[model samples]
Target: MGVFPDFDGLGGIGDLKQVIGALLTVVLIVAVLMIVVSAICWALGASHGNPSLASKGRIGVLVGIGAAALAGAAVAWMNWLITLGSQL
Candidate 1:
């Protein structure tokens, strides 16, 4: 016998999926915006010779990148887990 996820096993699962998808979309948009704004800040800081601002902007950019990477990887991670579970 094989085990797998039953998407229809619960009531309102479809709606839950929709909500999660919307949340992910928002996360990606915000992350992209953060990257753009942080890059601009970085440029301005460097041009004005402000080390503090530049350092903050650099950290923001890294955080934005990390957020995006995690958001993007969520689906793949979930899939991998499901597959791994099924093999047990």
Candidate 2:
């Protein structure tokens, strides 16, 4: 009677969780990339003799990188939680 094989179903929020997980994964990856880019931009923006400017730029870049890395880690952890929850 059915067009395809019988299955339990996705009537639950399984699909939603999967979508959230994928989104989180993407966010994590993007955050990491942005962190790296931020570091590079700081390095390139700094020129010799500008101690104050270079120091400030380095600090800002490091802070940005740290924030991005933290966000990325949180996103990755959330994604993992979603997957584990889906399985169980």
Candidate 3:
């Protein structure tokens, strides 16, 4: 069964697929924005000799990138997992 129940081809919104697609799009956009902001913060921190700020920015950059990658691959990852699970 699909994780989201369809109600007249829409799952609480206009089409479940469209809702998920929009959500993923938003996530990607936020992740890209985070990367840019973090990079700027990293540069500013390093220039001001603030190790704490720099470290936080660096961590944010990494996490944002990882999140973006995961979101991008979520569909493929889910399909793979489902296939593997069915085999087991």
Q: Choose the strongest candidate by TM-score.
A: 1
| Deviation in Å, model 2, residue 46 alpha carbon | 2.9
Stretches of model 3 off by over 4 angstroms after superposition: 1-14, 78-88
Question: 20-72 in candidate 2: lDDT tens per residue?
Answer: 66876776677566557656656666755555656666776677667667766
lDDT for each candidate structure = 0.83, 0.65, 0.79
**Candidate 2 wrong stretches, greater than 4 Å:** 1-10, 47-88
Q: Give one digit per residue, the lDDT tens place, for model 3 in 17-62.
A: 4666787899999999999999999989999999998999999899
CA lDDT for candidate 1: 0.83
lDDT of 2: 0.65
TM-score against truth, every candidate: 0.73, 0.45, 0.68
Error of model 1, residue 63, in angstroms: 0.3
TM-score of candidate 3 to 2 decimals: 0.68
CA shift of 78, model 2, Å: 8.9
What residue pairs are clashing in model 3? none
The clash number for model 2 is 0
